[model samples]
Target chain A: MISLNLVLFISSLMFFIGVAGVLIRRNLLIILMSIELMLNAANLNLIAFARQSGTVDGQAFALLVMGFAAAEVAVGLALAVALYRRKDTVQADDINLLNG
Target chain B: MNALFTSIGHNLFLVFGLLACAGAAVMILSTSAVHSVLGFLFSMIMVAACFLCLSAEFLGMAQLLVYAGGIVVLFLFVVMLVELTKYKEKSLFTTQIKWSFPLVLIALGIFAYTMKSNLFDAATPVALSLSSGLAEGLSVSAQNAQMVSRGLFAGFLLPLEILSVILLVALVGALVLAKSERVS
Candidate 1:
C-alpha cells in the first residue's frame, strides 16, 4: 500500500496553490474559486484523518464546511454581482470603495 | 496481475490527486471567468473521487451534489450576470507573483517537513477494510448513508440545524442583495 504521506502532500500542495491564486490573482471570481480550492483541500485532510481514526466525525464536519461554502458562495456572488453593477468591473484593485 | 490489483487504490489516488491539482492550476491560470468556473468543477469532482478512495462514500456523494451541482451553477449565473469582456483584455496574474511564489514555496516546504511522517498508522490496516468492517456491523454496508446520518443526527444535530439556519440566511441575503430597485 502507498503511504498516507502522499495524501497529505497532495492536500498541502493544493492548499498552497489555492493560497497562491488568492494572493497573486487580481480577479475576484478567480479569488473565490481559489478559496473553494482551499476549502476542498481542508475537506480532503478531514476525510483522510477520519479514515485514520475510524470515526465519522471528520466527515460530518466536512459536510458542515460544504454547507458553509455554499452559503459563502451565494453571498459572495451576490456581493460580486452588486460590485459589478456599481463599478462595471470585477477586478480586485478596482474595488477600493471600502478603503479608509 | 496480483501486484496490479493490490496497487490499484494507490494508483487511483495518484490519478485523482494529479487531476485535482491540474484543475486547480487551470482555475488559477484561466483568463476567462467561465473557464475558471469549469476548472473549479473539475477539481471538485476529483476531490470527490479522493473522498471515495478514502471510503467516505456519503461525503463523496455530498461533495459531488453540493459542489459540482449547486455551487458551480451559482458561479455560472454570476458569470452571466457580470460583464467580463473588459477583463479579457487584461492580464490574469498581477504584480504580486513576484513575491507570492517564493512565499508559497516556503509554505509548501514547511508543510512537507511537518507531515513527513506517515498518517495511515492506525490499527486499521487499510481504510477500505476498516470502513467495510464498520459497514458489515450495520444493516446497509456498501452505501454509508446510514453511518453519516448516525454521526450527523446522534452527535451533530445542533450543528446540522444551525447550518440549515445559515443556509436560510444566505438565501434571503442573496435575494435581498440581488434584488433590483424598481420605482413607479
Candidate 2:
C-alpha cells in the first residue's frame, strides 16, 4: 500500500501546478483546464484519505466533485464560445469589459 | 514472480501519481490549446489509474468516463470551434508569470511544511476507528461499486439529488449562453 503522505505530496504538486497554470496562462480554455486539474488533484486527495481511513464517504464526495466538474466545464466552454463570438478572442487578457 | 508482482503493486500509486503530475505540467506548459486538452486527458487517465491503485474502482471508472471521455471531447470541440491560429503567434503566458511563480512556490512551501509537521498522522488513527464503526457493511473487501453505491444512497442521497438539479441548470445555461442570436 502507498503511504498517505506520498499521495498527499503528489496531490499538492498537481494542485500547485494547476494554480500556476491559472495564474500564468492567458487563454481562458487552458485556465478552465487548469481548474479541472486542481479539482482532480483534490479528488486524488479525497480518495487517498478515504483509503487511509477505510471509508466510502470520500469516494462519494469525489463523485460529487466529478459531477460538479462536468457541469462547470459545460458552462465554462459555453461562456468561452460566447466570448469568442462577441469579442473574437478567447484570451483572458482581452476580456476587460467589466473593468470599472 | 510473486515478489515482483507485489513490488509493482506496492509502487503503483507512486508511478501513476507522478505520471499524473507530469501530465498536468504538460497541460500547463503546452502552447497549443489542442495539446493542452490532450495533456489534460492524459493527466485525467493517470489520476483514474491512481484511484484504481487505491482500490476505488468505481471512482476510477467515473473519472475515465466523465473526465477523459466527456470533458476532453468538449474541450477539443471548443478548441476547434474557436479561432486559434491568430493567437498562435502571440505569447501564451500573461504578464503575471513573474510574480505567480514565486507565489505558487510559497504556497507549496506552506503545504510541505504542513505535511512535514505530521498533522494528519495524528488524526489518522481516530478517523480509521470512527469510520470503521460508521461503515457497517461498506468494508474494503466489499465490491467497490457496491460500497460506493451504498454510501451514496445511504448517506449522500440528498446531495445526489441536488447535483442532478445542478446539472439540469447547467445544461440549460450552456444552451442559453452558446446559442447564436437569430437575425431579426
Candidate 3:
C-alpha cells in the first residue's frame, strides 16, 4: 500500500496548480476547469484518508462532492453561455461590470 | 517473482499521482480551450486510476464515468457552443501572474511545512477493510461497490437526499440561465 503522506502531498500540489490556473488564466472556462481540478484534488485526499482509516465514510463524502461538482459545472457553463450572449466574450477581465 | 509484482503495485500510486499532476499542468499551460479540456480529461482519468491504486474501486469507476465521461463531454459541448476563434490569437494568461505566482508559491511552502510536520501522525496506513457489522453475515471480501452503497444509504442517507435536492436546483437554475429571452 502507498503511504498516506505521499497521497496528501500530491493532492496538495494539484490543488495549488489549480489555484495558480484560476488566478493567472484569463478565460472563464479555464477558471472553471481549474475549479474542477481543485475539487478532484480534494476528492483524492478524501479517498486517501478513507483508505487510511478503513472506512467508506470518506468515499461517501467524495461521492457527494462529485455530485456537487457536476452541479457546479452545469451552472457555471450556463452562466458562461449567458455571459457570452450579453458580452460576446468569455474572458474574465471583461466581466468587470460590478467594478466600482 | 511475487516481490516484483508487489513492488510495482506499491509504485503505481506515485506513478499515477505524478501523471495526474502533469495533466493538470498541461491543462493550465494550453492556450486552446479544447486542448485544455482534453488535458483536464486526462488528469481526471489519471486521478481515477489513483483511486483504484488506493483500492477504492467503486469510487475510481465513478470518477471515470462521472468526470471523464460526463463532465468532460459537457465542457466540450460548451467549448463548441462558444465563439472561441476570435480569442484564439489573444494571450491566454492575465496580467496578475506576478502577484498570483508569489501567492501560490507561499501556499506551496505552507503545504510543504504542514506535510513535514507531525500533523498527520494519527493517519497511519491501514488496510482497506470494510466494516462487517454493517450487515448480517457481511463477508470481509464483499465487493467495494456493495460496501460503498451501505455507507451511503445507511450512514449518509440524509446528505444524499440533500444532494439530490441540490442537483435538482442546479438543473432548474441552469435551464433558467441558458434559456434565450423570447422576443416581445
Candidate 4:
C-alpha cells in the first residue's frame, strides 16, 4: 500500500500552487480558477484523513464542499461577467471600486 | 506477483498525484481564461482519482459530477460569451509574485509539518482497522458509500439542508447579477 504521506504532500503542493495563483494572478477568471484549486486541495486533505480514520464523514464533507464550490463558481463567474460587461476589462487592479 | 500487485497501488497513487499537480499548475499558469478553466477540469479529475485511491468512492464520484460537469460548463459558457479577448499575458501575472513566495512558503511549512508527522502517528495499525465505528453487530462491511450516506444524510442532515438553501440563494444571486441593466 502507498504511504499516506505522499497523498498529503500532493494535496499540500496543489494548495500552495493555488495560493500562489490567487496571490499573483490578475485575471478575474484565473483567480476564480485558483480558488477552485484551493477548495479542491482542502477536499483532498479531508478525503485522505477520512480514509485514515475509516469514517465516511470526511468524504461526505468533501462532497458538501463540492456542492458549495459549484454554487460559488457560478455566482463568481456571473459577477465577473456583469463586471466585465459594465467595465470592459476583467483586470484585478481596475476592480478597486470598493476600495476605501 | 504479490509484490507486483501491491506495487500497482502505489503507481496509481503517483499517477493521480502527478496528474493533479500538473493540471493545477497548468490551470494557474495558463494565460487564457478559457484554458485556465480547462486546466481546472483536468486537475479536478486527478483529484477524483486520488479520492478513489483513498477509498473515498462517493467523494470521487461527486467531485466528477459537481465540479467537472457543472462548474466547468458554467465557467466555459461565461468565458465564451464574455469579451475574454482583452485578457492579455502581461496582466495575467502581476508584480505580486514577490510577496506571494513568502506567504506560500510559510503556509506550506506549517501545513507540511502538521500533515507529515500527524498523519504518520495517526496511521498506527490500530487506527487503520475501523471495525468498531460503523456498527457493532451488523455483519455488513461498511463500504465507503454506505458509511458516507449514514454520516451525512443522518448525522449531518441539518447542514445538508442548509447547503441546499445556500445553493438556491447562489442560483438567485447569479440570475440577479446577470440581469440586464436598465436602459437609460
Candidate 5:
C-alpha cells in the first residue's frame, strides 16, 4: 500500500512524456531534457520503492542517480555546444550529412 | 487519516505532478530555449518535493541542489551561449514526421511494459512501520553514519573514483571537438 496506484500512474505518465520527447523533438537541447525527464521518472520509482521497502538502499541509489545526472548534463551540454559551434544550428536533421 | 484531509493532500501531490508532467512535455515541445529551460526547472522542483514527501530527505536535498541549483542554470547558460536568436532561419520541428508516431508508440510500449513487468515483479513491498523505524534510525545516528561511510568507501569506491575520469574525458573531448577541424 505504500506504493499507491496513483503514484505509479504518475510515474508512467512522466516516463511516457519523456519517450515522446525523445522520439519527436528535433532540437538536441530538447532531447537532452527528455533524457533528464526520463531520469526523473526513474528516480521517483526509486524513492517509492525505498519507502515501501523500509530500507535506505533505494534512496542511496537515487542519490547515485543524481550524481550521474550531473555528469550526464555536463557531457550533454558540452556536446550540444560543440555541435552548435560546428553546424551553426542545433537541429537534429542537420547532422546527417554522412548518409550514403 | 480522514477522507477529506487525505483527498486534499492527494490533490496537492496531483497538482504538483501535473505541473511536472505537463512542464516536461512542454519543455521538449517548445521551440524557445528559454521556455524549455523554465519547464525543466518546474519539473525538477516538483520531483524534489515529491522525494521529500517520500521521506527520503537526503535524496531530496541532492535533487534540489544538483538539479535546480546546478544543472538547470547550466542548461540556461548553454542556451544563451549558443545565441539561438542568431539562427532565425531554422525551423522548429524536425523534418522526420514519418518517424514520430511509430517511434513514440514503440517507446511508450517499452515504457509501459517495463513499468508493469519490472516494477511489479521486483517491488519488495515491505510494510512501513515509520514510527518505529524513525525512532530507531534517529537514536543510532553516530552508528548509522559509520555504516554509511563504510558502505560508501567499500561498495561505491569504484563509481566515486571513475567519475573523475569521465569528467576528464568529457573536458578533453570538448576541447578537441572545438578545434578547427575539416567539415565534410
Candidate 6:
C-alpha cells in the first residue's frame, strides 16, 4: 500500500520549495505562482487525509481551493498589470511606491 | 501478488512527485516570466495527476480545467501585456536566496524527522461512509463525483455560496484595479 506519509512528505517538500521561491524570486508573477504552489501543497495534504479518513469533505474543500485560486490569479494579475502600467516594471523589489 | 501492486503504486506516486518537484523548481528558478508560467503549468498538471492517484477524480479534473486552463492563461496574458521579458536578465532573483535555501533545507530536515517518527499515525482501516451510496452501474469516478457533490451541497453549501460572492468581488476588483483613471 502507498503510505500516506510518503504523500505528506511530498507535500511538505513542495511547500518548502514554494517558500524558497517566494523568498528568492524577484518577479511578482513568479511569487504569485509560488503562492499557488504552496496552496497546492496544502490541497494535496487535505486530499491525502480525506482519502485516508474515508471522507469526501477534503475533496470538496480542494474544489473550493481551486475556485479561490482562480479568483486570486485574476485579481493578482490585474494588480500586477496595473502596477506595471504605473511603474513600468514588475520587479517586486523595485515597486517601492508604497514604501513610506 | 499484492507486493507487486503496491510497488507499482509506489513507483507511480514517485513519478508524479518527481515531476511536480522538478516543475516547481523550474518555475521558481527560471528568469523569464513566460518560462515560469510554463513551469507552473507543468507543476499544476503533475499535481492534478497526483490528485488522480489519490482517487480525487473530480478535484483532479477541476484542477486541470481551472488551473492549467484558466489561471495559466491569465498569467500568460499579464506576462505578455506587461512585457516582463525586458526585465528578465536585470533581476532574476533576490539577494535572500543564499540564506533562504539553507533555511528551507533545515525545515525539510525537520519535516522528514517528524514523518519518520510517525506523528501522523492515523492508519486505521478506512471505513467509508459513502461506499453504500455507490451504484452498480456507475463508474468509480462517477460515484466519487456524486459523493463530492452530495457533501458540497449538504455540508458545504454555505461555503459554496460564499465562494460565488468572492469570485464576484474579484471580478469587479480586477476591473477597478486595471482600469485607468480618467483625468478631467
lDDT tens digits, residue span B1-184, model 6: 9999887777787689889999999999876677889999999999999988887888889889889988888888887788865774585788887898899999889988878887467585363345444433444445777778877776789999999999999999999999987888
- RMSD score of candidate 1 (Å): 3.2
TM-score per model (chain B): 0.83, 0.86, 0.89, 0.81, 0.69, 0.83
**Per-residue alpha-carbon lDDT of model 2 for B25-56, expressed as tens digits?**
99999988888898999999999999888888
RMSD of each: 3.2, 2.8, 2.1, 3.0, 4.8, 3.2
Order of candidates by DockQ, top first?
3, 6, 2, 4, 1, 5
The whole-model C-alpha lDDT of candidate 3 against the native structure comes to 0.90
True-structure Cα RMSD, model 3: 2.1
Off by over 4 Å in 4: B1-9, B124-143, B182-184
The residue-by-residue lDDT of candidate 3 on B1-184, one tens digit each, is 9999888776998889999999999999998889999999999999999998888889899999999999999999999999888987788799988999999999999988978886456557675565557844555345888778888898899999999999999999999998988989
What is the C-alpha interface RMSD of model 4? 2.2
lDDT of 5 by residue, B1-184 (tens): 6998888686765666777898887787787889999999999999887776665566677788889999899889888888777555666776675778687778667867766775665554563332342334444322433333343455567876786677677667756654556779
Q: Over the stretch B51-155, how does candidate 1's per-residue lDDT look in tens digits?
A: 888778888899999999999998998888887887777777888888999999998987776666434353442332224544556754465678777667766
Best by lDDT: 3
- Docking quality level of the chain pair in candidate 3: medium
What TM-score does the first chain of candidate 4 have? 0.95
Judged by lDDT relative to the true structure, which candidate is superior, 2 or 4?
2
lDDT tens string, model 2, A1-100?
Answer: 4678888899999999999999999999999999999999999999887877766788899999999999999999999999999989999998898887
Model 3, position A71, has a per-residue lDDT of 96
Predicted candidate 5: interface RMSD? 3.6
For A1-100, candidate 5 gives per-residue lDDT tens digits of 3354456768778987887787777778888888999899888987687567665556656666777777777788888888887778787777888876
Return the TM-score for each candidate structure.
Answer: 0.90, 0.92, 0.94, 0.88, 0.79, 0.90
Per-residue lDDT value at B168 in model 6: 100
The candidate maximizing DockQ is: 3
